[model samples]
Target: MANRPKKLPKALQKLSKPRVDHIPGLVIAAPASNSGKTVVTLGILRALANGDIAIAAAKAGPDYIDPAFQHAASRRRCINLDPWAMTQDAIRDLARWHIGASAGALPDGQSDGQSDGRFVLCEGVMGLFDGAAGGGGSSADLAAMMDWPVVLVVDVRGQAASAAAIIQGFANFRPDVRIAGVILNRVGSPRHRDMIMEACARAVPDIPIIGAVMRSNDLALPERHLGLVQAGEHPELEVFLERAGAIMARDIDLDALLGLVRTQGTDHGRVAGTNGNDGTNDTDGDHGRDHLPEAGSQVQDQAVAPKDDGAAVSRYVERFAQNNANYAAPVTIAPLGQHIAVARDDAFAFCYPHLIAGWQAAGAKISLFSPLANEAPPQGCDAVYLPGGYPELHGAVLAAADCFLDGLRDAARRNLPVYGECGGYMVLGDCLVDGDGISHKMAGLLPLETSFHQRRLHLGYRLVDIRQQCPLGNVGAVLRGHEFHYASTIRADGEGWLNARTADNRDLGPCGLQKGSVFGSFFHLIC
Candidate 1:
């Protein structure tokens, strides 16, 4: 007899993947940045999750940080769905993937819409219509592609009547973007709310005001260079989310909002509003540039290389037109050596949750160790992974980590697979110079030295080609990822494989270091 279906592991199964009548999905968008979308989105997600609702959160852009916060707030696995860099099919598949497993794997038409599911709560990036390349990659673009409704969050502070005008303009701005409803954020008082409600009735009479959030200091999230301070750093995160959820439940029309999302939806719904070409400058879309690199050109920093087979990098170019994200398992960059030792701590905490989750899903055992505490990788582990983070802030502690340093050097000598990125790459190097210009000795596994003292932002999307023998599969394997760091390479020795380019299609040259079995680069893989 055929084997019966075994239950998925609890860690994966614990995620709320409800079999539903329909996926009541909605995009929490704003008229502009800082219009209170993040807080509003979080509150909505937290409230729904607390009520035993199966909800999944997503961000509609190429950001790694905001999704972390969304995941934290919703207590669910959140994914990033980008329009510019990722194909429409990839976006659609990922959208469905974000919602739990459906009884049928086909599109809504192939099977009935009665599949079990989870609702997607997407946090829009920038403004609703802001796209760097034409209007091709905006949050509106994603909404249009998926035929999903957008719930606009408007800050009604300082002006009451003008808020209605903003809503009407947006509702009538683009025919392709559907403005399902509006949420008035930061209202002054009952009178202020009443005035805005009346104005909204006059301007966009049909659009419902699903929420009227009053101005309060409690809902704000702290910010920094990347974005909001990491969701993990928040001490009273649970308390904050609970309070925020209560606020949304008390103020926002959760029942009406859920009703709007539950309406029989189709991908071919009639779009709302329209747009005109008034001639404005926009960056040209990211073309492959058709430039190929010669083999054996080593790079100093981490970068991507072209695959020997050269799969057209621009295959996933169009939105609302393609049919596959070309899903691939993240190339196993760590040793298949029985056990995996991952460095996890404040000083080294940039590992992607998906990669680790994937490892566990594949039945791999994971062991975590802290380099900050001067602890070494536990015995019996065959592979070691050191992810990137703010090592500059904890330079003295890492420098004094003799056990970790010695154990790491011993691992390298023993030829165990070792890898690093940015800060981790710094740890695997000869030395790291902190922002104070003080030097500290590192593992000295790779012939490299990096410095935070000479910091400069090196931020951009990258396409990598694994051209040589390494943990990330054999030669000719290709990967799409990004590089963001303030540290710079101050010294390097032996050659490294991999060539890459910017989103603007500029050559980034060869990058990554490979000395014996130890290797790493600063690029963080997304696919």
Candidate 2:
């Protein structure tokens, strides 16, 4: 990042500043995945979003889909706060910028804007303590780091007394992990729920039973590979949200759950969210208050609510004027491209919505074309972005896409900026092997080959030190992203240029292959 600007990137100028906030949030976790974490979390988000209790939602670990559902539930742009992929500073900065900051100042110096630091509800990824490397990047790890309480969701389907054992194990397993409350999921009957609650009280009297969700097949969301289908792809997401919210609001005790998140961290003059945890902690000098920002002000305004249906919603930062209307609004300093061509389809669907929206807000035009549908990039596009997706399943069809491949080849020969991520990274190589061990020729942009036959998961947070200038950033640019792929490299194009390190600062050595204007890796850029 030698050519990087001395000043902070305009994107983070508003945020990245150190401002003290009485930030109090909770992390919803489970013992293992498929424990109804997503449904319960969404239910809570919807139940609390009555326009009175100011709430902000975030997702722990490196996931793109859950955050979308979170956003749909809360009507806010859900931030991805991966403890593994991001530093402590970055995680806190994002939370503060999106959930803690407000547009105007208050008499008590508290926020008077959208984010008044009232309540931050975060959904955990996978199991509570599951991480890419040990438990460093897990949801429990994030809670411990942020000084937040953990609400463990146990799927008590067929067990009654054993549920208390599960609760006790999670609560007492780690001292650093503070299991403040428990939410029982998939209860067969009211009697069943009572039995579990009784068992829980007898086992761990200190741990509170916040709620018990009744089992209902109708409440389940449609799912496929890559987790629950993206919120945008679901036509009845809004209906599902309404139903989930109704169930939670009807079944759960809102006041009791709010009481559980009394004070995970120090309540330094907190005047936003009420501390009604029944005197659980020393909140002597604390008085919860709500302050709204003054009119016609601007500080943090990135989240946009979706329209009527559960259709796709895009989030991007908007420009603001300094004082008067005579001057032009402040603009972003850097952009991905003037006119960008993007490979967008079911085959390539993991692009972050915020990135594209931010680019457009910076005077960049995006032209999306589908390669799976035998379409090439739109004309006059300067840069092409191929996001990660399930390319291995469609290897044969993609290989026979002569029109798409030929066009990409021409674009690569012209030295147009081209970047691939994960599956896109695989398709840019010479050949890709499908699940059946069938070899298929790809764009041949880079001299590399990969196979999914001998699958091995390479998943974690990566800190990248750019070795050369690329469209993403300048040489020496320090970028934080994640790498989660199953493809094993058969031939790695020999010479690599990825300068990366794991979350714990272990050197990953050369990882990516960059050939001319085409550069790719099995890494997915988050920020």
Candidate 3:
């Protein structure tokens, strides 16, 4: 028998039309990691959004910070489209979901007069062509995947006409990826912008000059041990976004600029009913031959299954029914799962909000534990999560906290799942040698020792292939994550337990180790 019919809300049914057109969008790309891309993108989005345009925002790769800024600028829920971490279908679905949510509205809710025109603004990653180690899955790759036009955000500093040459190379380097326009960022003055404009006009006349943002030291956001401070922590973030929007609106020629972008077609028809068929068969079939049930009924039937593809479809239908669900539901852990205690303090706070949200949404109760307070795992905590942070800074305090150390050791002995990131990875080691060559005691759960004295900057987004069964998942399973730390950890006895490797096939030594239930890794998983 076919799966039961999923009931959707009346409001959602009324607004069920596809929101995104075949028209390709725009991706604001850069040459490197910090090239004022976020500020420029935010300015563009805010300026356009202020004009009553229905806007959908997306992050090009596995980033949590830029999306937050995008959300604030566009006044919409920004979605992350990581080619490595998420499937192609997931990327398209995310775009369509945001487009749909932004285009339609309830009878009683806020409605901007004309709702037909929906535009998507995708913010690119580190560099335009840089991707995971093997050289695939770059921002350019994502732009090609979505058939989006590229709006390069070039930081116009230290070079004048050389910037134009760089832009020219990027434009001609990849024939398939479209470079629509350029937004000159960090331009020194009006004369600086004029020089940049003239250079670009001479070197790459085909690429239009959209906007030029002046250099402003005051606009810089503060950085923490991690990347930029989390958007939530920035109280004046909205104010900054507004000021940025005003600046762009005043300076940029929004209408003429947007007109330069060519709309490319997408194949959305391929994705319509391919969500594992949760009984949304709009096809002609024999009604008497198959016993079909209601939408919620089908969901109830699959409620007991460990991983139900149909459940995701049913959940989608339910969200459509509610008419309040915004972004597409991400693939998550099973609901009614065991509880996990996650360490979340200033010293160890690199957990992804979505991962935690996904886990909680999947029915895993996340209990927040603090190592800085020397807090023990709460009663009945089934698992422990120790994310990356500046544990090295609090080495003395952590060593002094015998209770927290003893609790971690006890948890390890009890066979509870204990996952750790860079800083957390050090915590599980026998000892940590600080920058001054002073060693401090740790939990000694793993046969490893880390040294901050001899610092080596290991930074990149990694594609991890699971080599053994552990709390995360099965062997040979690939996961998208990132690694950024200044410490070097080597096996004390030259024995190692590394799992994944870089895109170049070079082993990223012992990303994850599993001894009984004790698991630790320097890689921070995004999905």
Candidate 4:
């Protein structure tokens, strides 16, 4: 008999209301990566939020942090719309749900219904035209699909006329995508702004100039090894956003900007599935294609597959879709009857907020457990979760923490679900390789060994096929997730237990390994 079909989550089943017609909005796009699009977009969101404007935020790609900042600026939860990660149906549903006209008084300071119309602010990823490796999945693709106007955010630090050429190329490169206006970011002075604005007017006369933000070293966000510091870690993030918004309000043309944006029409239906029809059902039939592998397929099947860089790009696109769809109908896990201690100190703080919410929704009580200050998992907790974070930075302190190590050993002995990711995965190994080619003794829960000395950036979205039964779910089940880590573990002297691979079939060795009650891997589960 064939395997049973997986049921769609409750969140995905409900049909959303139709979108409101003529809803004003604009998406902020840039010429390339690191163009300061996020800063400018967030500043606008904050400034508008201070008024009577009922603004909604949407991200054009699969980013976790920027959306958090958008959420802060808009005083609402931001939604993601990625052309690659999700089906068109999901994106339409999200747009319809949030794209309604405002009726009540402003939550900020403006009188109710002053800026009564609804507006969405979408922040673009990377470059506007730079799609994924496959060349089709991009922020521009999303703009064309939604028919939303695009506001170009240009960083005019070095060149003036050259910047105009880049903007003109983007405006003309895609005839369908409308470049509604421009936001000059990081301008040096009034003269620099004037030069850029004049050049842009001459080159792309159709696209209006909205704002020009001057250069400011104060706007720079803190960064770590991976990217911008996670928003959760930065408590002063609100203040930073307010400062950026004030600067933008002082420098940019706020009212002229509002005039340039064209409201989008209502009509939230999806462009039928790949079959090219107009319906909500998935034509591909198979859902969670990114997660589970076909049954009876060995790891060797993936070993010989052609290297399609497009697969990586598609995974990135799919992330946006998945995020939006999941939000429409959030997965509610079984409740935690007993308290589950989670490690959440600076050394182990890389857990996704959704995962914790999932656990709590499922009825599991959450109690934060700190190992950094020599604190152990709380007594009577049923399970312990050690998420990925900067364990390498505090290797010596962790190596010397007897209480934390012993507590983990006790939990393992008691047969509790002890799950870990990237940094946490390293802690569960027999030994961890430090920066100076030295190995530090860890919990030794798993038979794996990891090294941080020889670093490599292994980053991408993933689909995990459950080869064996563990705590997360049943055997043969698939899980949506992502992998980003610098350490490489060598199986020094134990049986390998976990197996993983990228969406395009590259080797991702020993991701979800389990030994008794302890299970760990470098992969971060998003669902």
Best by TM-score: 1
Tens digit of per-residue lDDT, candidate 2, span 220-261: 988755677778778999889988877766555555456444
C-alpha local distance difference test of each model: 0.67, 0.68, 0.65, 0.64
Clashing pairs in 2: 1-475, 1-476, 1-477, 112-291, 112-292, 112-293, 271-289
Give model 3's clash tally: 9
TM-score winner between 1 and 2, please give it: 1
Candidate 3, which segments miss by more than 4 Å at Cα?
A: 1-25, 42-58, 63-80, 93-120, 158-165, 198-207, 222-245, 253-328, 332-337, 373-380, 400-410, 461-465, 490-498, 508-511
Lowest lDDT 10-mer window, candidate 4? 268-277
Give TM per candidate. Answer: 0.73, 0.70, 0.70, 0.69
TM-score of 2: 0.70
Each model's RMSD to truth, in Å?
A: 16.5, 12.7, 15.0, 16.5
lDDT of 4 by residue, 28-71 (tens): 89989899988888888887787545566888755656776777
Model 1: lDDT equals: 0.67
- Per-residue alpha-carbon lDDT of candidate 3 for residues 1-527, written as tens digits (9 for 90 to 100): 35534432222122122223343357889988789888888887777677666466778876656776777778766777777666677666555555555333654334343221254678898889988877676899988887777878898898889899989999888877877767777878777677766776678755556566667765677786557776766879878877777766555545434433322332221111111223332211111112212211211221111223233333332333235225444443332137888888867866655466567655678888888899987879888888887788788988888888898888888888787778888898889988888899999898878988988988777768777777676767777777788898656543233466675667666555567677677787766
Candidate 4 local lDDT, residue 156:
85
Q: For candidate 4, what is the TM-score? A: 0.69
Residue-pair clashes per prediction, in order, are 13, 7, 9, 17
Off by over 4 Å in 2: 1-20, 46-55, 72-76, 100-119, 172-177, 219-226, 229-243, 258-342, 352-382, 394-407, 431-433, 436-441, 452-456, 462-480, 499-509
